[model samples]
Structure formats: structure tokens, C-alpha cells
Target: MILREQLITQGVSEKLLDDVEKFKAFYALTDQNLTSRVPQTETVFYGKDIWAMCISALLEEENILLSGPKATGKNVLADNICELFGRPQWNTSFHVNTDSASLIGTDTFIDNEVKLRRGSVYECAIHGGFGVFDEINMAKNDALVVLHSALDYRKIIDVPGYEKIGLHEATRFIGTMNYEYAGTKELNEALVSRFMTIDIPQIKEETLMVILKNNFADANEEMLSQFAGVFLDLQAKSRNSEISTKSVDLRGIIGSLKTIRRGLKPMLAVDMGVIGKSFDQYEKEIVLDVIRTRIRESWEAEDIFPER
Candidate 1:
């Protein structure tokens, strides 16, 4: 509901909002057990244009792929979309080991009888939940081949040796992949063709401020700006090839701010959240310099958060 209002503040149209409401109403979840799967987000995705585009695509029943560098808020937006539509989310984290059995289903013995153990995608399709495929490119093409029928015009999952199931009308699959992450590879043409790809851009400082305000309301505005600057400076360095995007992390900044709220020193909190991400000593030094330049070595929690 907060994201709906924020979307309005960001100039997303009333029509799109109305459509999302209608979507929620039409595909209402009756499974009480799935209530917990509907995510409650700590942060919101802030781009009105991106929001509108995603709303439009989902309205037309298109599966979308969010393609971008790290920290572009792919998972955040996917989570927000699930929240907006009031859909339960089933998050499938792809890795080298991800395969058909892990995604669809596998058989297991219970009570001396072999029964099908439902997988995330299987459950997601049957319940009309939003399925978020994270780092999809990391999985082998053959592994994801099981999803072809489910994602295409057929809209069905045909499990071998079991009954084929139709995807619930409200079901939408959202895939996200980073541009340059370890153990990731190109998505094969067949897999890529199924998605309406949305290229996510880097977060702007203004948007970053709004996110910070949303998550850390007690934090001072100047301190929030400084935190935002830390990310942006790292982003600038990344763009110029001075450093990899590994240290230019939005989540790290948010986590650092959270640790600061818990009375950790600014530099140490950033060290854990941002600087520690890069294992390379040279990279860590660069990240440290970028962060220390924005936030002094001696800044305290009181400097960032005001009295409650």
C-alpha cells in the first residue's frame, strides 16, 4: 500500500494503479497458507517509468526479464510488483546446480511410498504466485529447458509421468540477471526469447535518498545524502572502470545504515557491508577510500540518526 502511494507520488498513472487493483481482486488468493509468501518489503523500487512499464507488461500477461548490473534493484522491483499485485512470491535462486527436479518437482519416499515433492515453480504455477528467477543465467540451458512450455503461449507445465497443470491466470514469472557476476553466463536464445526484457539502469542519487528515507526515517537528511553519495561515488568509479561494481552496492549501503542505527561506527559498518565484499586487498582499499571520502573515519551513530 505504501508503494502504491509512493508510485502515485512518483507520477505513475491512476489507470495503472487501478489495473493492479483489479488484478488483485480478480485473482484473489484463497489459499490461506500462502499468505506468508506475499512479501512485505523493507524498501521500494523508485522509478516511476520502470514501474509503469512493468505494470503494463504484467497487465498484458507478459513474462519480464530484468537485466542490469548489480545494485540496480532487480529483486527489489520484483518483490515490489508482488506486493503491489498482492500475489504470493516464489523465489527460485538459480545456480550451477539448479535443474529440472529442483524447479519443477522430484519424487521422495514418505511412509514407504514414493510421492511427488512439489517444487517452487510447480507450486507457483498452481497457485498463481509470482515466480522470481534470480540469476537465471547461471543455470545450464538444458536445466531451464523444462520451463519452456510454462513460459510460452501454452502456459502449462507438463511434468513427466504426472498430470500436466495449467498456470494460474495470475501467475507471472520475473527473471533477473546481472551483467557481470561470477559464475554467470549468457542466456541461450530460446530462453531469452520468452521474456520481455527490461534493462534496469543504475539508481540516481535522488531515488537513493527516497529509498533511504523510507527505510531509515529517523536518520538525518544530511547523513542520508552522505550515504547516497557513497554509493554514487562508487558507481562513478565503476562506470569509469576504476573499480568493479562489486563494491558499489545499494544493499550494502542500506545494511551499513542499519548497523549504524544499532550503534556501530560508520566506517566499521561500511567495512562489513561495502568494503568487505571485495576480497582483493587492492579492491578493498579502493572501496575504503571511496567510503571514507564521504563518511569520515570518526563519525558516530548520533551523527546519522537523530534522537527518537
Candidate 2:
């Protein structure tokens, strides 16, 4: 089944699903070409409660703010929400350099005439698309102030030197923030108040195993469990301040499994995906020790997956 159907089957209220479909049908009637803006995602968000909260917020026309640690599937849920609602998605990765000009439109000289170059936020607002503001706290408070009006009840964007534009009724913003990450600033109260915040919990062991099995169908249960154990171990260490979060990478584990499927040694594949991501020698050694404790040297592709 498609994502929308899956969401409904997964217990998203039928009423909410009807509303989303109506909105999508109305959007289609407008002739807005938003196919290119839709995000294609392979990952499925598994939490029923989280999905329910997100769907309810979007149905109520409230902006969503997902706060969590790394690998909690924030981006995945954001993408899934847009897919479920049949809305186009605009991903804006915020960093230290992000500013109001970057979120809104800017004037540029095109063919000797000043033309307005619309940014992701501007386009998403006007087209009634889902705007995913990733790592929002990474940007300075002043830079994020531009979103206040758009996120609030007003739903308006006052672009400098341009006509005041009201956001499309279907427009919604999903902001994600990792408060524990280094160099990320605390979100200002005003901005925080504008969003209906949800604290995303780390994926449970059962869910992680499911994700692994789904992604690496060729791998055996033993190897998948081992990888999940290693991931949880790293997460525990990171939580206790024994290690940096650099080693707690869900994507790295999946990438390593793929490499193993390609006939590379398990250790080498793990190193390339997990250990090699850290540049610091000490950090690498710490991660390598963690892996060594979980993965034995004698393991091979055949050991991890007998069918392979």
C-alpha cells in the first residue's frame, strides 16, 4: 500500500485522513505543479503515538516542532507526514549562516533587471507545501525571527521590498532540533511558543530490529540483533557522557550492512561506515573498541547471513 494508506491502517484517525485527502484534492484543483517538490522516502516512521500527535497537529493547522537526539527519525517522520498529507515538501537545513534573506526571497539582477529569487520558505508558503526546517536551533535567534509571523496564527510573510503575502491555508512548517548537539543554540522562547512541540523518543530495540530487517532482508536475525546491540550500546555511552554522539549513527550501521552484502569484510565495512565517520583519533579508537567488543574478527558475510 502507499504511504497514505499505510498511515490510515496504522491508526491515524479516519477523519484526519479524510481532511488531508480533501485538502489534497483542493490543492490539485489549483493547478499548482508540486510534484517536483514532493520528497521520496524509503524509511517508515513506526511510532503510532508520535504519528497520531503529528497528524492531529497538522490537521489543526499548527506548526510542529520535533525535539530529539540524533537518530530518532525526526526527518523521516517529517517526510512521512508530507507524504501522508499528499503535500509537496520543502527541506531547509538551517545552519549558523542561515538568515531571513535565505528563508524569504531576495532580489537579484537577472538580465539587468532586478528579479525576486524565492527561497524554500517562500515557495513552500505560497504553494501550501510542507516546509521542513531541519536543525532549526543551529541558526541564530535573529535569523529565525523571520519565521515568527509565518508560524503564528497570522500566517503571513512580510517580505522586505515585496508585497505582503498571506501563506496558503494548507501551508505547514515542521521544525526539528537536536538540543544536545554541540554548537546548537537554544531556541528562543518566542519561536518555541509558536510551535506545538513533540519530544521524539529514541527508537526502541524492537523497532530498530524491524527497521534493520526491513532494510537488510538478506541479513540473518543474529547479525541484525548484534548490530542493534552495538547501536544501543553507543547510545547508552553517549547518554552517560562516555562518548560523543558521532559514533551513534543509524545510517552508518545500514551502510555497513550494505557493504557487507557487497562482500567486503565485516570489520572493514563497519569501520568505513561507523568508525571512519569520526576524524579524531581518540574518538575513532573509542568507537573501534566498542565495535571490537560486539563484532568478532572471524565473522564474515557467510557468518552474518548464511543465505549470502
Please name the candidate that would achieve the greatest lDDT relative to the true structure: 1
TM-scores, all models, native as reference: 0.92, 0.90
Residues 1-308 of candidate 1: C-alpha lDDT, one tens digit per residue: 58788789889999999989999998887778887899988677888888988999999999999998887789989999999999999999999999999999999999998878999999999999999999999998999999999999999999888899999998999999996887898799998899899999888878788888888989999888988998999989989998887888888998999999999998899989999888989988898888877899888888998773
- Which candidate number would show the highest TM-score if scored against the true structure? 1
Worst 10 residues of 2 by lDDT: 28-37
Task: Report, for every candidate in turn, its global Cα lDDT versus the true structure.
Answer: 0.90, 0.87
TM-score of 1: 0.92
Residue 214 Cα positional deviation in candidate 1, in Å, after optimal superposition: 2.1
Residue 20, candidate 2: how far off, in angstroms? 2.8
lDDT of 2 by residue, 195-303 (tens): 9999998777888997898788888888789988888888888889878888888888988998888888889889888988888898788888889998988888777
Predicted structure 1: lDDT: 0.90
